[model samples]
Every structure is written in structure tokens, then in C-alpha cells.
Target: MKKALRRYWQTDFWREFFDTFLNISDCQNQPNLSHWGRKISVLLKEDPSRLRETCRLLRIQDETILQAPSF
Candidate 1:
């Protein structure tokens, strides 16, 4: 189960996440952003380095943007 989740996190997660964000952004949904932000905050608290590595693997250059959720 962990492996499957890890795989999803590394792959489909980013795609779906970005897609969802774009949709939410287009709709000007603040609540959805807050919900997603909480999830990201929890993930960051769980493993910062791993998150960083996953972002790096995904070629996510916006480190500050990624870290913003935990603030």
C-alpha cells in the first residue's frame, strides 16, 4: 500500500494536483486551495527531505511556492 501510494505521489499526484489547482484557480475557489494547502502542510511536516526530492524528480523549480503551504 505504501509503495503504491509512493508511486502515485511521485507520478500521478503532481499531474492531478496541478490540474485540480488550475481548475480551482480558474474558478477562483479559495476554499479548495485552503483544503489542498492543509494537505500539503501535513505532507511537509511528515517528510520535508522526501518531499524536496520528489519535487526535484518532478523538475518542480518553485521551492518557495512549495514551502509556502507549511507557513
Candidate 2:
């Protein structure tokens, strides 16, 4: 979770979202499989292009997680 959060923070798009008052609580209320999908959907409602950028950023984040060493 920490690593994922870190990778999420590393993205410019996510940084903007964080700065724009988007909170983890928004995701906390969502279902597991739909958390990200829902969050992106909400963001898209606000700004459609941002959704695409956020998705790309998240994909990079996911890749980072896959490449990270396990303890």
C-alpha cells in the first residue's frame, strides 16, 4: 500500500489531483475492484482528458509496483 501510494504520488497527474483536494477517503468508500475505476470516472466527470492522463500515470505506477523488490 505504501509503495503504491508512493508511486501514485510520483505522477504529475496524481500530484495535481492531490493538490486539487482529492482525498483517499473518496476511494475508501468505493468497492475494491471499482476503487480506481470509480475514482477515474469521477475525475473524468470533472475533466475528461484528465482521466486518460491519470490512467496512464496509474499504469506506470502499477508497472513500478511489479518491478519493485519484495521484502
Considering every candidate listed, which one attains the maximal TM-score?
A: 2
Cα displacement (Å) at residue 36, model 2:
10
Report clashes for each candidate as comma-separated counts.
0, 0
TM-score of each predicted structure versus truth: 0.41, 0.43
Q: What is the C-alpha RMSD of each candidate to the true structure, in Å?
A: 10.0, 8.2
Superposed Cα deviation of residue 54, candidate 1 (Å): 9.4
Which residue pairs clash in candidate 1? Answer: none
Q: Over all chains combined, what TM-score does candidate 2 have?
A: 0.43
- Candidate 2 local lDDT, 1-71, one digit each (tens): 33233434337756655555544467555435366567657657787665666677788888888999999
Superposition error at 19 for model 1 (Å): 1.1
For lDDT, the strongest prediction is 1
Off by over 4 Å in 2: 1-40
Q: What residue pairs clash in candidate 2, if any at all?
A: none
